[model samples]
Target: MLASRFGAAAVAIMCAASAPAFADDTLKKLGQFQSTGAPGEIPQVEQGGKKAENLRAIAPKIKVPDGFKVELYAIVPDARHMAVGTNVGVVFVGTRKTKAWAVTDRDGDDVADEVKEFAPSIKKSNPNGMCFTPDGFLYMAEHNRVLLFPAAEFFYESPDVAVEVIAEQLIPKAEESFNHGARACVVGPDDKLYIPLGQPFNVPPKDKLPLYDEQGMSGIIRMDRDGKNREVFALGVRNSVGLAFNPKNGELWFTDNQVDGMGDDIPPGELNRATKAGQNFGFPWYGGGMVRTKEYQGEQPPADAVKPEIEFAAHAADLGMRFYTGEQFPEKYRGGIFVAEHGSWNRKKPVGARIMFVTLKADGSADKAEVFADGWLDDKTGRYLGRPVDVAVALDGSLLVSDDLSGAIWRISYKD
Candidate 1:
């Protein structure tokens, strides 16, 4: 029934409106299908007051799979990408402002009873991402630097301690703008910190710098835990908001957001798999294998530069990739890749704003994209409830997707 209505309605809209309108409606219809329940609300948790349980959505309602349930994990007010500690049983998330938080399930009920502010009044240059290492130390990505605090301090009893700068003065400054900031970081299989530095203002570079420059260093960079041995791990990437190392195959995967100013539907965004240390996925010169604008006189990728493993629609704004290693879902979904699309602002029509699952082949490659959660972006009315920014697997093997638009977190788990 839904398909029949969508087919007819889409054809008429496609015929009447421009390609942007047609693409928006079609993608929304594809992303709108989910077994929805009552709305999930954000709970207000103060320092001492009783943590509120029932909070309402500041944006649109979230959607999830069948037999799967969703609840508001934490209403962080401006939450970003999340990091989980396997040993600590604690979830750490950051905000763009001067604060980062640790959400913990103390009583083991699988719900966060306590949400503590770890670093307060932080410098809000660009607090983008955080992650933990196999040895159990916590790391936070400060723009051009990293602040490391003891995980034991957050879990055990400790006063608010100043974060120690394990890495400093690493990222080179951009001349015009630093919008990309330090996007995300993760400890790879080699036990090294893999951090992303984006292009400066999306402008093409005229000449390479003797030291580190923004254009050349815009890709993923790798460093030791002590911030030593800094080198470009990958190149030709404009901005990758989220990245993860696959547990099954030990390969690094990333979601790269393309440049703006091209027509709405020119080049699709990319889900790139980093096969080697120095692989260069096309950016600036070519996006999704489509030639982009000639502005800034960007150079196209060399014929040797690799293409994306999976291509999403233009301006989908894909972020945060996580491999689902949970038992709640069917066997086929055990190790699939889950991505959060933050939705598009420059496009005439909206895309993303939801959590999507892509089935993986035995070779650790993507099959086709599927909607694991929806309703963050409205389908019928063409509005958005919230924009999903990041996704992670919780302690209980459930999925947690962060809504930056509404300052909320939605937890998903499957049941019989």
Candidate 2:
């Protein structure tokens, strides 16, 4: 009996070894569908739940400014960066997961009426960067490629809307890491598309520096709408998950996640401003700003490394930010910035998981950073109910915050 069992097990192992290796299912499904077929019904589309009970339970816990009120806008799963559509009451959201989502408010109400999968035909891997041009084109930056959807607002409901590839193999496919794979993109005032390419390592090895520098890794790169005139805009950006162009002067501002494993309060996260191209924000050289990392402690850094304009708390994991240009808020809020701190994962005591407000001076520099909203993380238990990832200003001038942890988009509006 023992001999017979052994023989059977050997046969099973041999059969398993002979089986063909499976290809990625998502890649096979790419470009398979292109038509919506029917209104309000798309296959594999998941709608955002109302979740009234869950909203009521957490609504009171969220603390905003005195005159502002927070309400549940929509329940978007794995929501990350957002792009507000022009002339269409639609909000396009990117995700670190498989799909992108579109949240719409059809009846002129502040609340979102529908949330559905965007371009179900496309197989997206970490499509976490989205931006809209003034001309009504929507561009999405995925892990391995960039795509442009022409007239996205008008043709979003139709699956057959035109799709164009801006670029492929934006980053080296072999160097892809799950830790910092999500890319952030924005359309700059210069009519160029800017995308950040984060280095795969916590502190890149000495041997990899030359290759990284040559490939524009750990830096921001800009190119024309057709992917021409590509050049490195900024360097030494460890992992910037958010990028925004200031409406006043067209300067670029972004949030960088500092290195991990350091003591809690030594190296702070960064809010950096790049006034011109070819600037380098200190990274592995100076983890956040001043504190140096052990990996490159003895090495010399670029002499012209620019410092951060504002420093956030250590391990804050600042992700997405947008300058407040809307008129719905108080006068003080105009020209200010709203940042979503996604919270820290490696900290012994968790920090962040809130919305931060940065007041800017007339010259476009930040004066101070303050907490705009809180209560997502429980101070007593070190537990977070939601992790805010991105902030977008709606057409009505309300602020929309996307929380990937809670799978919800929240709206903060002011009342007189």
Candidate 3:
């Protein structure tokens, strides 16, 4: 049939092109899809019931400022990052697993009415980071590839939809790792896709620096929306799961998870700022906040390595961050920042499992970092009730936070 549709020569050429893709499981899985679905074919995610009630039960435990309130928004399994669509009021969530979900509120209520797997026809890998462009294109950043779904909000109901491959094989197969596999992507002011390619090691050897730098693996790279003309935007990053662009000045600010194992309270996490291209944020050399790593202690870092705007507590595991551009909150929250501290993993005493609110000065400089919401971590027993992953502003000016532990999304809004 293919030969009849595209001539004998064209079919031969296409077969040769696709022959290599079958060799890799990652790309092979992506090819398993259907243009349509059978009876009861599409997978559906239950929206409410016990799982949601449990999340609501934990809501009162979540403490917020006096004027603010927290409530259950949706029950999404393994929800990691969220992207709100333009005009449709649908929120697309990505997970570290294979599923990405589309959360909807059909009755104009604050709570979600439906939660379903998005584009279930196509298989996926770790689609953890995602963001939407203003023009209705949803970009999903997998561990090693990026996929573009146009009109995602409107076409989410169908299992089959148009999907475009923005980039294939972001890194070599040999370089892929389960550690630090979460990649963050955002559309910059210049309409370029800025994505961070994390290093696979806690502290890599010195000999690998040049190769990693050339591959843009240990840095943030920006490419044209069509995945052309890619260049490294920043270097020396350890692993940054969060990326946000300040609206006022168009500068990029990100949260970097510093090197671990130094001690519980030694190297600190960082929230960095980037104003231009080719800038380096100290990594391997300085694990976090000027503390040199043992691996590269004998070596010197770049003299122009940029320091962080705010240094968070060690092992806080700061992940996704976003600028507060909504108006439903108090005036103080306007033009501010909201970052999710995923909490400490190996720390003797757990430090964070909360949402941090950062204030900006009149000149758009970050001034302070304070906990806007907490109670996710039990101080006495060191138990985690929930771990917040990412934060996004809803269309109604509220904040939607994704929690992988609870497999749910929570909404924070101001009532007073």
Top-lDDT candidate index: 3
In model 2, the Cα lDDT at residue 38 comes to 33
Greater lDDT among 1 and 2 belongs to 2
Candidates in descending TM-score order: 3, 2, 1
Order of all candidates by lDDT, from best down to worst? 3, 2, 1
324-406: candidate 2 lDDT, tens digit per residue: 97999999999899999999988888999999999998778989999999989999999898999999999989999999998
Q: Write the per-residue lDDT of candidate 1 for residues 1-416, one digit (tens) a residue.
A: 01121233433343334323423343344323332221233232462233233334332256565677777666666678888877657777876666666777777776667776654433445666788766555678876668654332233222223234667665555432456664688989887888877766554554643233433455888887667787789887878888988898789999888877677885788888888888777665675545554753445445777778788878888988888877777776788889999888888887778788888887888888887787777777668777888888886788888877666677787778
TM-score of each: 0.81, 0.89, 0.91
Q: Is candidate 2 or candidate 3 better by lDDT?
A: 3
**After superposing candidate 2, which stretches have Cα over 4 Å from the reference?**
1-40, 43-50
TM-score of decoy 3: 0.91
Report the alpha-carbon TM-score of model 1 versus the true structure. 0.81
CA lDDT scores, all candidates in order: 0.68, 0.83, 0.85
